[model samples]
Target: MFAAFDRPRISLRDAMAEALTKVPDVEIDPEGTFKYILVRVKDGDKQKDIVRGTKAAEYHNHIFDKVKPALEALGMECECLGGGKIEHNGKEKKIRVFGESTAFGKAEHSVSVEKLKTVFSNYEITWSDDKK
Candidate 1:
């Protein structure tokens, strides 16, 4: 026997997961228990030079166009955190990922760190939550 209310919750989780599949190579936290998803670009040595100038802006725009909507579809308020530079290996590098923050709904959601890693594996996308 199960509570009738539990069905809708399960449905929503499934729906959210289904929506996420639209984004190529994306992974949502399976727990879906995050308050915010921190998206940051990794500034590794080789990528330092390429993710600069117009290229960076273009990448951000692409994220806005592609990633933002997918998150929004899952009921998240997406915030764009433009380009940023970080010091890695003692070198200044431009961050590539554009999505920085997101507010989650009152339900558990799934987050695929691996998928995010794969998609922006070169740039390094990270998520932040109250739990952290």
Candidate 2:
């Protein structure tokens, strides 16, 4: 049995995963927990996508605020950190993920590369399982 509540308890990572379905060009902590979300932000549309050049960051914030609860229902965490930009392809891509400096999963836990590829698509994304 569960207690009744008005709002759902949502962490930050879940939000980022959903955002990936749309914005799949950001870096996350190796683990699935919230630790790093480093990307530029925009209005989640093409205009902002080109102008501000941080669609991933924008969607990151959007998920934490709007859809985090939904993601929690599915079971995950979502977080937002400071702003940053990363070099990818021939341009600097904005970066934003989840979690603070305290999350253990940040550098400890790991995720399935195949799964991440499924989410982020295969363009410039590359990974080699260190554990293997």
- Report the Cα RMSD per candidate: 15.2, 14.5
lDDT of 1 by residue, 48-71 (tens): 001211222233344345555655
- Model 2 whole-model lDDT (C-alpha atoms): 0.32
Per-residue error at 115 for model 2, in Å? 2.6
TM-score for every candidate vs. truth?
A: 0.26, 0.25
Candidate 1, 20: how far from true, in Å? 12
Per the 3 Å backbone cut-off, how many clashing residue pairs does candidate 2 have?
Answer: 24
lDDT (Cα, 0-100) at 19 in candidate 1: 46
Per-residue lDDT for 1-132 in model 2, tens only?
Answer: 355575697755556445545544433433222322322233223210110112344433443454345434544343333222222342322222222222122221122223334444643443322322
